[model samples]
Target: MTPLECVELQLAAYNERNLKLFLTAFAENVRCYRLPDMVLTIDGKAALGEFYAANRFVHEGLHAKLLNRMVVGNKVIDHELIHGLGPEPMETSVVFVIEDGLIAQVFFIPAKSPS
Candidate 1:
C-alpha cells in the first residue's frame, strides 16, 4: 500500500477495534512519540498491540475524522478530530512515517490550549 493508504488502513483498524488488523500497518519496531517533546511513548509492535488491547475499546463513540492530510515522500501528516479518548472531541495532528510500506514511526501532537 502507499503511505497514505497505510495510514488509512491503520485508522480503519483502530475504529474497528481490531487489534490484529491494526497491527498489520506498522513495522515490528515501530516507534511512537508525542510531538514537540518527542518523548518515546511506545516501542515495537508488541508494545503497541498491548496498548491497544488495553485501551482501544475503553469507550464507545470512538472515531476520528481526518480534517486534512499531506503527503511528502514517505511521510503522511494528518490533522484530525478525535473523539472518545476522553469526554470531548480533540483536535490533534499526527505524523506517520512510512518505510517499506509500513508505518515506522508516529508522532501524535494534541492541540495546545492558549496560555
Candidate 2:
C-alpha cells in the first residue's frame, strides 16, 4: 500500500476502535516519538497495540478528526483534532513515516495552548 493509503487505513481503524485493523498499518518494529524533543513513547507493534487497546480504544467517544494532511514522499503529516480523551478536545500534529508499505515511525507534536 502507498504511504497515504496506509495512513488513511489506520485513521479509519482508529476511529472505529478496531485494534486488529489498526495494527495492520504498522510495521513490526514501529517506533513512536513525541516531537520537539523526539522522546520515544511507543516501541514495537505489540506495545502500540497494547497501549491503544488498554488506554485508547476503550473510550467510547474517542475519535480523531482530520483537519489537514500533507504527503511528502514517504511521510504523511496530519493535523488532527481529537475527542474523548478528556473533557475538552485536543489538537495534535502527527507525522508518519512509511517504509516497505507499512508505518515504521511516528512523531507526535502535542498542541500548545495559546497565551
Candidate 3:
C-alpha cells in the first residue's frame, strides 16, 4: 500500500478502535513516538495494544480529518483535525514512516492554534 493509504488505514483503525486493523497496519517491531517526549517509545504490537487499551477510552469516536498530506518516499506527514469528546477539538500533525507496506514509526505533534 502507498504511504498515504497506509496512514489512512492507521487513522481509520484508530478511530474505529479496531485493534486488529491497527496492529495489521504496523510492522511487528513498530516504534511510535510522541512529541516533547522523545524517550517514550511503544515498541512491538503487544506493547502498543496495552497502551491502546489504557487510553482508547479517551478517544471514543475520535477521527482524524486530514487537511494536508505531504509524501516523501516512505514517509507521510499529515495535518489533521481530531474530532471527539473533549472540551474542544484538536489539531495535530502526524508523521508516519512506512516500510514494506507497514508503518515502521509514527510521530505526533500538537498543532499550534491561531492566537
**Top candidate by TM-score:** 2
Candidate 3 stretches with Cα past 4 Å from truth are 112-115
Q: State TM-scores per candidate.
A: 0.93, 0.97, 0.82
- The CA lDDT of each predicted structure is 0.91, 0.97, 0.81
Q: Which stretches of candidate 2 lie over 4 Å from their true place?
A: 113-115
> Tens-digit lDDT track for model 3 on 1-115?
9888898888888888788787788888888887866655688878888888776635776776779999999999999988774667789888899999989888877776334
Return whichever of 1 and 3 wins on lDDT. Answer: 1
Clashes of each: 0, 0, 0
Relative to the true structure, candidate 2 reaches a TM of: 0.97
Considering summed lDDT, which 10 consecutive residues are worst modelled in model 1?
53-62
Superposition error at 76 for model 3 (Å): 0.7
lDDT tens string, model 1, 1-115? 8998999999998888788899999999999998788889999999999998887656667788889999999999999998888777889999999999999999998898325
lDDT leaderboard ranking? 2, 1, 3
Q: Which of 1 and 2 is the better model by TM-score?
A: 2
Q: Cα RMSDs of all predictions? A: 1.8, 1.8, 3.0
